[model samples]
Target: MEKVKVDLVVTGYVFNDKKEFLLIYHNKLNKWLPVGGHMEQNETPDEALLREVSEETGLSVEILGKSEIGMGGNVKTNLATPFHVNVHNVGDHDHCSLFYVCKAKGSGEIKLQEEEVGGFKWVKKEDLNQEFIPKDVRNIALKAFETVE
Candidate 1:
């Protein structure tokens, strides 16, 4: 059997003044992943990233700067990211992830898309090692957390 391909995914490294990272509980796979989703038609990778972040965390995020647009705009390959593959979650498919260093105005009320994402949390970087996020995602979060200050 052939492995399924996610194709593309967008992620946001949401940071708070306390230097905590925002993670969401994805209902699709029942795993904690970055706040992101599949790219919709005619939407740019950045647009998709921002949309997903808002939909998941209800936080308005800004794209700090430019990043490489991957093939078909399926993935956003940012140089600022710590990973080699543009997509953080690989082994699933050839994907490019758009990573943004964003700040939430405050810990406002979050409106999670219950069907897509069940819950969200602002967790400290150190706490992740003891938590259960994907290895690749945890590494990416750690790198982003270090520079969020």
Candidate 2:
């Protein structure tokens, strides 16, 4: 049996009031995907997600959903819950990804990080069905739209 290496990854489905969600064309993966990346050591999934989104798309987003518990005693803060979670293959390895729903907070202009992202688009729910989008991405995107709208 092949050794399966699973990494912790985080992604966000960032939506706007216009009912559009953001998608990035990843340079390495060569696929349309949400803004996210592998979690760094000693970082929480939520922190990693926010950092990744900022680095990849340059959009300031507020993660949707909230924690019921308040921070106290050792716990500095409570993180938002992910709307969806899944394990998917990324060629040589696999990613156990946490998916969060978010909304743009300000101007929402995207400045792509060319080293990681090839391009970006704010797509409508209907756009998910396009042939260029992988089925998993389409399904998750639709779910994000459903959650937001």
Candidate 3:
């Protein structure tokens, strides 16, 4: 049976100290995009961001923004605020994606998940103007860079 469900996904615009952004060439999608994936059960968005970033690039990152929300009484959990949210179609299903800005913890080699990504690169802000990059991703990436500056 075909699964028709709206999946919650997270994306990160990860920048290094040099202010370059990390992008991955998704083998399945055949496009260059930020690192992210579907949120796992029982995991907060911040936790899922860390997990996805580590799994995809092998680099530890500090997600930028508030990592907690006060919901009145004694309930508090670390949940990074998404810089942007939008829904997009993914073949048979849809993905409601939360986009975040992040910074690499330290300098390190990026190890790609060969099965998922064809390649990866650290792109400068100017390079974001390239035609290959989607307009929305480019816009958000530019905003992320500006926010950190």
Candidate 4:
């Protein structure tokens, strides 16, 4: 079997007017998480995030800006300085995640890709405290919410 190459991935925290965060169920992890994925060849982080969020959640979002959240993409992939990186073992592989905040264009029923995700939901900030997202990502979401409020 071929090892999955570590690379820089971008994620978007798509929040709606109702203050609900968009969460997707990742089939690989069997857990719920924010919308994001690997950057395609020659794609910038911002560009990659926009595409990933739209593909995963079926919603349009505009990325705010690049904020270093002490996050990392992967160990094998060389990441620039000031990114908060932590190692999370995923079976034989590891995930070093970078996150960003984004604003959705409008609210509507999400069209999920069945192969990649089992489902999606709009989670409120209060509900996130007990939700399945990682602490770091949750912190980012909280900060985004606080700023918008």
Please name the candidate that would achieve the greatest TM-score relative to the true structure.
2
Evaluate model 3: give its lDDT. 0.88
Candidate 4 vs. true structure, TM-score: 0.74
Scored by lDDT, model 4 comes in at 0.72
Kindly list the per-residue Cα lDDT of model 3 for residues 52-98, writing each as its tens digit: 99999999999888745557667675567888899989898899999
The Cα local distance difference test for each model comes to: 0.70, 0.88, 0.88, 0.72
lDDT of 2 by residue, 71-101 (tens): 7889878888998999988888999999999
What does candidate 2 score in Cα RMSD to the true structure? 1.4
RMSD of each: 5.8, 1.4, 2.6, 7.2
lDDT per residue for candidate 1 within 66-90, as digits (tens), equals: 5565545654445334222474344
Per-candidate TM-scores read 0.74, 0.93, 0.90, 0.74
Report the poorest 10 consecutive residues by lDDT, candidate 2: 125-134
Per-residue CA lDDT of candidate 4, range 1-149, in tens?
A: 78665656776677787878788889988988888888789876667777888788788886655445555676333222212334455676666666666778876668887889998878888887774787876777777677457
Candidates by lDDT, descending order: 3, 2, 4, 1
User: TM-score-based ranking, best first?
Assistant: 2, 3, 4, 1
Q: Lowest lDDT 10-mer window, candidate 4?
A: 75-84
TM-score, candidate 1, is 0.74
